[model samples]
Target: MTETESKARVAKFHIGQVVKHRIFPFRGVIFDIDPVFNNTEEWWLSIPAEVRPRKDQPFYHLYAENAETEYVAYVSEQNLLADTSPEPIRHPQVREMFVRIEGGAYRPRDLRVN
Candidate 1:
């Protein structure tokens, strides 16, 4: 295996799963995933040193919301936690991209082509 492959970590979460920042006060449903960091270095460095996450782990794109408003977020797996709240996310894009399953997790809306 390649050296990069050997160091790769499996993502602990999946697209359409609801999650929250480990320290922030917001929650969202994952809409995309990157196996490793794929963003600009400036963005990575913008985070406070004590809270910054390593780039080798998975990163997620979320349609995120807090009590007052909604926005998109790019977050690292190490900085996230599964959101077990029975309440659904209020981000409008979530409905456009997913469906809530019976167990309270969101699932991607099937977009099969015939």
Candidate 2:
């Protein structure tokens, strides 16, 4: 396998799963998934090399919130784990994209990527 192919991993989470950053203290619901890194190079370069994720792994687009702010986060699969908090997420945009939070997952509304 090519180096990138050999390193690629199947995404462990899915759209609508709640997850937390493995290193950071933010939590969010997955709204989108990229099979491989697809963000701008400038964004990639902004992360310190020592902590940057490899491009071959799955990347998630999340509706994320922290104590101080709410925003979307593009995170690597290696940097996320399932969120176990009983509290619900409060990111404002989640209601626009999901039908409801049921059980431990968010139910997505009809998705359009235009």
Candidate 3:
């Protein structure tokens, strides 16, 4: 297999993986995976958008969730774990539901009452 195919793609992680952001309390699905840039030895996960930084500069070394800043932590292959088992402790920010209320094309609800 080509290096790009292997390294550029995010490594697979099962759902309910008990992954903690090396530097943030935000942890969720391995929902997506993308291999590290040019570096086959690393991997990037599809973490929550709130936990993620801007796209211009992607990827960060894993650090303790309590880490004060990015400089203090280091993420490597060793830091990554593959465990699909669920966590007993629920995350604080877990949204209970995503109610998708579609808005019709600028039609005001008041019009129906008239």
The numbered model that scores best in lDDT is 2
Cα deviation in Å at residue 113, candidate 2?
A: 14
23-82 in candidate 1: lDDT tens per residue? 999999999999888899999999999998988889999999998999999999998999
lDDT per residue as tens, model 2, 1-90: 777767778889999999999999999999999988989999999999999998999999999999999999999999999998878889
Which stretches of model 2 miss by more than 4 angstroms?
1-7, 110-114
Q: Please list the residue runs of candidate 1 whose C-alpha ends up more than 4 Å from where it truly belongs after superposition.
A: 1-5
Candidate 3: stretches off by over 4 Å:
1-3, 6-12, 20-29, 38-77, 83-89, 95-114
When sorted by TM-score, best at the front, the candidate numbers are 1, 2, 3
Q: For residue 41, give model 1's deviation from the true position in Å.
A: 0.3
Question: How close is each model in CA RMSD to the real structure?
Answer: 1.6, 2.9, 13.3
* Root-mean-square deviation of Cα positions for candidate 3 versus the true structure, in angstroms: 13.3
Q: Better model by lDDT, 1 or 3?
A: 1
Worst 10-residue lDDT window, candidate 2 = 96-105
TM-score of 2: 0.87
How do the predictions measure up, each by TM-score? 0.91, 0.87, 0.29
Q: How many residue pairs clash in each candidate at the backbone level?
A: 0, 0, 6
Model 2 residue 50 distance off true place after TM-score fit, in angstroms: 1.2
lDDT (C-alpha, whole model) for all candidates: 0.90, 0.91, 0.32
Clashing pairs in 2: none
Candidate 1 vs candidate 2: the lDDT winner is 2
